[model samples]
Target chain A: MKPGPFTYHDPTELADAVALIGAHENARALAGGQSLVPMMNFRYAMPDHLIDLNGVSGLSFIDCGERIRLGAMTRQRDVEFSSDLQHAVPILREALLNVGHRQTRNRGTIGGSICNLDPSAEMPAIMLLHDAELTAQSTRGVRKIPMNKFALGFMTTSLEPDELLTEISFARWGKGHGYGFHEYARRHGDFAICSAGVLIEADSRGEVARIAIVVGGLGATPVRLSAFEAAAKGHRLADELIAEAAAAASRMDALSDAHFSADYRRHLAGVLTRRAMKSAFERIGVAAYV
Target chain B: MSVNGRTYERDVEPRMLLVDFLRQDLDLTGTHAGCEHGVCGACTVLVNGRSLRSCLMFAVQANGASVETIEGLANADGSLSILQECFHDHHGLQCGFCTPGMLMTLTEHLRENATPDEQELRVVLTGNLCRCTGYQAIVEAGLDAARRMRAKKEAAE
Candidate 1:
């Protein structure tokens, strides 16, 4: 398979890259090319102009300051190996391990995964869990979009044609926050059939002070269990509460694919949510009910 | 791109894959093209010391990058590298279609991790699909190669 003929532009400056994509019609920015290149080879995507972003400066930094800031072009492998990130957000590394194989992760970019917005992609689900803020730049200027409002539909993002995702930043959970990311896939590197991400902060009394739960691969976008999170806040993490949250996750509308039925996905959502919550609870040194 | 310790300058189509450039343009046929998509890691090579799927990258994208391919894995005397030798010793291949990729992938892996556990090697190999050998022999070859490389490093030190 070969990609269709397209003029390629390698821009070293962010402004130049933004201007080129904005100036050309049917232009697509090439991030790590782990996903887009394969689509190009299959002729599923035939952009008339390919704007390569690898040479662009200031798009590959990992600033673990007050907020965890990641440049759009930051490689998944880099994120997986970042000790700072591992300390700040261990769940990210756990999810990233399942994103793809080592070879793909070496070249795959977080920005690409987020902009592609695959329903089963781990990066988007992690961003959703962290409430990440994405910065988009274009000739028109820059704007910040919350991760919750980033994805419009399956493989579709709220980004304009010319806008490029520059950075993703989010506030880190407090120290000792319990986190768990669980997914069930046929193979190790395969996309998850159903995935769950959970983050919990425990109060002094070993009660749940705050919690965030996001289930992916069940619908067009990751479903955030905000209602469950709110209800469970300030309550002890009991088995019944976890079951209730899992039940709520199972009842959410899920997409049915050829291999997996909606019912099966719903069932998996419940099972994985329970497992993820239990793992999160255990991380907080709480004796979760077995 | 500088490939196999030699730098080559050429003009190519923007959409030409790095694998195609290596095989067709540079005549480096050792890098096989299995699944042209990113799934099969048959076209894996080291770009700037990091293993990446050549099929997933365009030739234009590799400009000014140092690439190490299967052709570069051999000794200067035309003999097999330690990894290839371990592959032969372990029967790591049957049809040999996926050997190049497995070698390149492990070459980088061993360089980074002088000693990798069996589970770690298995996880590292999940990217490259080897349908012929069922991966057991390949895993054994990888372990052997790692042990030999570690010994060599220790001896040199």
Candidate 2:
């Protein structure tokens, strides 16, 4: 299906792009056009103007320093293949592989995925895991938002019509931090039915010094299992401890759809939480206490 | 737009998808459009040398960009390219609906990782869905093409 007619604006400068979108009431920024284009084709999104960011300069970059920063227009495939990201934040790379296929990732951008805020998107869940900082730019000025507060609901973000997500930054994990990402879909490269991402750091005693688990595709937005994290924190890695955490995680409310019942997703939430935690612990080179 | 090494400039509507622009305006019908929402990879093309779903892009979005479609997969002398020949030699295609997309996708994949094992080849082929041949022949064809391309490069050097 063809999309509705709209004026296309290709702004060569970031300022010009912002100004263009700010001036139009129903204008939408075009990042990778992976999600928005499909929605527009179906007339689900009927923007009167399209502000294409591809022509905007200086918005596609990956910088790794004290904190990792990714420009909004950076493609997912670029992140997947980046040696810097692979070294500094391997979890992001691992999660990115579970996104769409190579062709889609070749065109999908990090900003697009985050801004679209699909309940099952990997980038948002990864952001939740790292407490990633997001920068939004508009004609007014710039506002920094924590990733947790960025997405308001399903397929909805806190981004104002006049604003564009400019950059995302996350702290580099310290040494000995291990990350695990796992998602269950009907087929390879499909959207997850239930997904889990775990980050663990062992203290001197090799117990669970710090842990964060974020689950996606089972709720209106990516959910941070804080209760589960708190339950497992400072506890020795053991089957019983993991089960307790998983059970707490499963108790959280999740969405139910035609494909998966709520009970099934809840079950998956528990199973995936356990698996991700185990995988993360293994990466840290520690055996789970039987 | 410079498509298949030929430059053509035409005013297009923002609503017009690249696949439509290719088929209707440019008459480059080799690039098939299937499942316009991007689930099926039949509308795949190379935008600036990277594989992209043409169906998911507006024609205007591709303005001033270089696009390579299935029409350019043949040699200038009109013979099949090595990848295409491998498909024919290995019976990679049955109904031929997904052949073009498969070709464009593998063309990009083989360029990056010249030699992919069978498992890796299957992983790469997951993007393009072929209804026939059960994917075994397609994987074989992709592996065979990678070998031939590597050999050709080695011979040239």
Best candidate, DockQ: 1
Tens digit of per-residue lDDT, candidate 2, span A201-222: 8888878888889999888899
Query: Which digits, one per residue and each the tens of the lDDT, describe model 1 over residues B22-108?
Result: 999999999999999988899999999999999999998889999999999989999989999999999999999998999999999
- lDDT score at residue B111, model 2, on the 0-100 scale: 85
DockQ of 2: 0.76
* A1-290 per-residue lDDT for model 1 (tens digits): 39999989999999999999999999999999988998999999999999999999999999999999999999999999999999999999999999999999999999999998989889999999999999999999999999999988998999999999999999999999998899999999998899999999998998888899999999999889988889888888788878987898899899898999999999999998998899998898876785
Residue A200 of model 2: what lDDT? Answer: 87
Clashes of 1: 0
Q: Show the colliding residue pairs in model 1.
A: none
What local distance difference test score does each model get? 0.93, 0.89
* Worst 10-residue lDDT window, candidate 1 chain A: A281-290
Q: Write out the backbone clash pairs for model 2.
A: none
lDDT of 2 at B149: 91
**Candidate 1, which CAPRI tier?**
high
lDDT of 1 at A51: 96
